[model samples]
Target: MERTGTMKTSKKMMHCFLWVLALSLIPSAFNGCGGGGGGGTSDAPKQSNNSEITVSSNQINFGSLVANQTADNSFTIQNTGTRNLVIGQISTSGAPFEIVAGSDHCSNRTLLPNQSGTIIVRFTPTANAVYTGSFVIPSNDPDESSLTVNLSGVGQGLNVTINRVDSSVPGNIRMIVSVTDANGDAVANLPNTAFTVFEEGEHKPTIVVSNADVHPVSAVLALDNSGSFWASRLEVQNSAKTFLDQLRNSDEVAVIKFAQVIQLAADFTQLTSAAEINNLKAAIDAPYTDSINATLLFDAVYNSVDRLILRNPNNRLAIIVVTDGQDYDASTLLPGSTHTLDEVIAHAQQAGVFIFTIGLGADMHTAVARRMANETGGEYLYPPTPAGLNAIYTKISQILINQYEITFNTTKLVGTLNNLHVIVDDGTMQGDDAISVTY
Candidate 1:
């Protein structure tokens, strides 16, 4: 029994010795493979001489950003070496562009041995400005100490819009404006109150007031083409040709003819050459036979005021109305109808559209001509004979070249005489001052 007990003790001791040796080998293997000490908790990291870490994309690509647009990007890092890594101080270095959210914007983050993590970068631009920056990524691993990432983008343009409205009662001038930029966006901080209103060919009017934002020129030409004037059509054409010949090429002129119903000889067009002017006149003179309908004479006048004069706020505006005689259909949109002629006339006047009237002989409505001219500080003419057309045209040409533009900040008033005060010559109305108000 004593011998058996001794043998058992020896075997147990041998087993214990083998277990200790095995445990020692396990730690050695772990230390060699992991490089860092194999202890579960080791504050001091083990250093490896033969290991390295590298970042695949050192640059973050953010492509094609527009104004008010945002963008994002990311890159990966790899540990090809036998050591652990702790990334420290990842930062962006550009203006206007800021880091919104992501790991890329972090400072001092840990990365395990032979392990990799992705860093995200984000950008948001405030204005129309281009930007570029880099992320300075610092790491504990000497081989991959610092990783540089590039970021870039562009700024966009401002958007603007312009809208105009006309409100004239019994022949007064009224207008309002709204503006935006090229991107179809409203421009907030614009100095629109300093905007100035000027007529084409005219010096800025002497009406010393506020608002100086400059605008384009607006104009409408209402032509008369009727059977009653068929014999004198050529003469009327000559006068029209002469009048148009003197107009600036920038003028947007529309020609309307009325007999049976109102028709457009031509929509708005710019007069470039004498040939174009002659062509316009010839178009007016072309032979046509349509029984004159009860004329919506005032309706045509009002429509011109609404469509042409009150559409674009960036220009000087005016209307020239031509007619020959009585309305066959007098039961149209006059004072007692859907839209009163007086209202239309008042709107045109208030919108700052100068009104000119051309009457053919005694057969024309003298009252309408007189009312339109008187309301807008314009002139009314009666060409009795066909040959008188050229003379009338000459006068019109002179008037076009001699008129001046005067914008006054009249106390916003109501009713017909709101803007009807006489534009007195303040010694400021000279040859240079006498500019074409109706382009």
Candidate 2:
């Protein structure tokens, strides 16, 4: 009985030893087969190193812009990882917002580790309203493959002004119109079918001439450099240069600065090159005396038209005058004052010149300016502040560049003071003008 019990105890001890050995080998088996327990083994799972994309901004606000004006902004994309970032696709939402071509650095390109790229965005609103859109970019970023940039803008209203109407030939009348939306913003692409005409207080079938058919413009800039305008002299000169910059290569411009007497700064010259425009700017920047502190408004107007009428007789002629005060010389205060208001008007009529007048301050003689513009079939403007000078000049330049010539048979109304009226219908908007035509 004792020998059998001893044999059973031996057998149980052997079984316990085998179980302990198997438990000890389990950790070694797991470590040899690429498990988490291994720290310095070649078969361990590798850590991931992925490329990431980060943007400079996610939103862009364009503030406020005039209709048809263009504005731009830029954003940056950085690759913040250990691998190269591949850009796949780039696109915009729709109109008024676009990715400017040649300005994107990430299109179908690879950005190495820690490298950055740029994307330029442009906004051009066609009408008055608030607009919203987005720009999308797809890349090989591990976390974020698709990115978006939000865009917003506001467009303001546009104001149109008819400056003048004149007839060089017997049966045709030329109308000068100015269109602007905001400071330094001019409206464009106005169609020809937007005009109508009435002759002798009767509706006349009018023919509209496209801007391409009109001849090049001949314009004279009449500036008032009196003591009252001293505060805005530099700005005035700069604004006049802006006006010259807006003219076409085929257009001719002359400069006339007046205080008590009219001084010709530049003769009629084509603005074909930068040198010519700079020469005119330099002439405008020349020195002048304030000793004769009188406003020779009428004399200046008459002389400016006289200078333009002879140069481009067949081309469209115009005189733009800027003044801060009334015609002090109209009272005959200065010695040897040559021209009167009536004589100036008659000369303008005979030469078929349109006159545009701009009044600066409350002391401006609005009545006289209005009379001159009205009698010559031109328009008068009174800007609220000096900062608005550039915009007004830009509008005038656009007007000269985009005028319509309307023709009607006036042979039956010869020697008669006929009333002329015009209407311009542009889809949702309409404009009208009336004047007296004497043959």
lDDT of each model, Cα atoms only? 0.54, 0.74
lDDT of 2 by residue, 1-439 (tens): 9999999999999999999999888878878776455545655665458888888888999865556667778888888878999988788998999888889888788999989999888898877678999988799987788888889987655434444555546666555555444443444576656566677667666566455325788889898887677788788888888998998989888988988777889888898999999999988898675444777777888888778778756677788888863667434665334677778877887777878788786577666777787577565666788888888887777667756555555554446676766665456644355566566
TM-score of candidate 1 on Cα atoms, chains taken together: 0.43
Residues 209-307 of candidate 1: C-alpha lDDT, one tens digit per residue? 322233434556676554565666677666776777666776556677665566677666667776666667666666544555345566667777777
For all predicted structures, in order, the TM-scores are 0.43, 0.57
The most accurate candidate by lDDT is: 2
Model 1 score (lDDT)? 0.54
**Candidate 1 segments whose C-alpha is farther than 4 A from its true place:** 1-217, 273-279, 287-290, 330-340, 407-439
Tell me how far the alpha carbon of residue 237 in candidate 1 is from the true structure, in angstroms, after superposition: 2.2
Which candidate's TM-score is highest? 2
